[model samples]
Target: MRQWTTGRERAWRLLLIAALAAPAVCFADGDAVTAKAKTSLNIVVGSREARPGKEVSVPVTLQTNGLKPAVLKMTIRFNPAYVSYVEEEDGAAAVGADKVVTAFELPSGSLNVVVAGFNDNAMNDGLLFNVVFYVSNAAPQGTIVPLTCPSGDGVLSAADPLAARLDVTATAGSIEIICKGPPAPNPVAGWFDAQEGAGLTWGESAGAEAYQIYRSEMNDPATAEAVTDWLPSTARQYVDASILANLQDYCRLYYWVRARNAEECASDPGGPVDFVINEIPDAPSGLTATRGHSDGVLLMWNGVPNGAEYRVYRSNNNDPATRQPVSEWMPATFSFMDTTTPAAQYGIAAGCSGRLLLDFFQYTYWVAARHTNGCESDLSEPAQGFRGLPESEAAGVLPERGDLTAWASICVLLMLAHRAWKTRKA
Candidate 1:
């Protein structure tokens, strides 16, 4: 009976130990109670820097590590006092193990989304997921972004706080100028020319104190050579005629203008204006020519200053009396290829004979320059070239005899014959 009782007690104690050990084993294998599940939640705002009138979008992502899925109830709360909140989509209640996304906008208020939540089993955890929204007429100029997530749980769970500072900035405004010029040919005058001055205009701006005008002759607008004193009020139009000049004949001239406030603060340089200067007319010079290949002759001359056009004349002979001008004057060019002035037609050389060729042939040509203003220069030096047979034409026409002996014998016979005839006659 003692052994039986001892055995029974040992069995009972073993059962108690087994019960305690089983729970420990189950816990160690992670099958006892719901394993401490870990989940990661994140929040993102589209643009931390938003304009006062512009809208902003915010997104939230939740992730978890566990077999059973978690019911992630994400609620974005904003500081109603500062900003307005508009829920773009309903809350994501049961967020799977995978990532889930939710977006919202700040309709009105300064502070945006403030809290987030996750429900798993019967346990609930609140996540601090908040974003602040702000608006301003001007850009927020700074490096750091100010964002905070204020979180709290209904179950009194410790609030997990999160924050992200936004990098907000403002956009700059631009100033430009449009220019108008005078009619062609007449060209704008100096300061007196109304069309010569640059036209100034401003695009968009809240309000400027006093507008200032700046000018620079060099291409660089930053290094302005001159600046106008601060005006009493902002002006849309300002003329800078100081740099205008009639003597400026270059193809292109550069100009730019900018505005400033009463405090002497200046905006960016205005758009650039390019002006074209009209050229003045001048006369031609140095006209001359020489015989070229073929029956043609080549005429050349130096370009005339301020000369807009040229006229060329051809004469049949060097003597003005024998010289009749060609039918019409040819338009002046740097060089004239006189192919039509044939050697025969112009009585240029002795070989030429077609139309009552002259015995003594000497031809001449002349050139004159005309300006755009109808100004003409004196005729160029007459270019004279001669073409005629030499004084001893007989020498060139006779043929030469190779043997004088034969010619001598022939001459003696002719003399003897002449003597015989004379004797007979006697």
Candidate 2:
């Protein structure tokens, strides 16, 4: 009996050892699968400056150096009087997860967040969740709304239920409630997306730390809070490149410039400047196409300042209306090489081959400058080039199809045959 008991004990010990040697499971893919680095759960409370009765939505973000958690639970604590809890939004961490279960009691000042996923699919690092709170109208100016994450209430675990995580931490941030009304308004002077550059020049504001540039589609209002990060006061001009790609070719864009003080107070949006984004850039200068090489045409032009690129158009006719772009868009370079070989076309019934029957083809070329804001400049002066049969063989080639070399050859053959027959009859 004693020997049998010893064997059972050894088998149990071996099973335990094998279990401990197994690799831990992960719930997220990519290089950040292993939880080898530290993980921090931070409360990102925004909108420090707010008017009374305004709603503030503070986000809870999960910041991790290298760790990826499959399940996370955090509890937030805040005062109920100054800022009452409105509701919870799980839309943040619910992404990529099977489901996110969140439970919180309003007016109690404490909320809990729980996010979990199955298998190797879990929410990556970013905003874990959002908690919204309302500032009381009666709340006096300079009121303080404190937010905190209590100790031991935060839990982050790996996919394996049995796995333990000991390197996780939590941080808390707060929002200061203020009722400072909108600052005085300062109007924007002028703005343009032209040869000089794409930006706006505005009047300076006294006691301003920085200026804010705001934009909206045509006929829409630009709000002060909608302005992007503050620009240094000295940066009186703001060059916006995104407008070039987003706005339509001829659409009107509205802009407003405001000043932000050191206290984060935003002045009223100033200009309803109807800055047009679709204006064409200045026409390209010195447009010329040369037959320098045997196989290609060389096109060169002078560069346009603040120009996004150049468009090259080609047509058999000299009329600008008939010309079509060689390519959709090209870089802001001053040169392009066209290697398209001219081919011959044949129509037996027509006598003259319809295809550029002339030994040499004349092509008209035009160049245009394109600005960043979807605007295009007018066509440059018309320039002509001869392609195909080398210049040596293209002495009297006309632009019309019937007078081409193909028709001339046929006419000469017929006349010679008649002359020969007449001579034999004589």
- Among these predictions, the greatest TM-score belongs to 2
Worst 10 residues of 1 by lDDT: 23-32
What are the per-model C-alpha RMSD values against the true structure? 29.3, 20.0
Give the poorly placed runs of model 2, Cα more than 4 Å off: 1-47, 106-108, 153-172, 183-426
**Stretches > 4 Å off in candidate 1:** 1-49, 66-134, 140-144, 149-197, 200-426
| Cα-based TM-score, every candidate | 0.24, 0.32
State residue 385's C-alpha deviation in candidate 2, in Å: 99
Candidate 2 achieves a global lDDT of 0.58
Residue-by-residue lDDT tens digits, candidate 1, 243-343:
45632523334444444443333445555554433443343456665532233445677767765666666787555335443424345467665555544
lDDT of each: 0.39, 0.58
Tens digit of per-residue lDDT, candidate 2, span 184-297: 345565656544334666777777777777777544563323445778868777676665554564445667877777655556666766666565577889987763234456
Q: Which ten residues in a row have the lowest lDDT in candidate 2?
A: 22-31
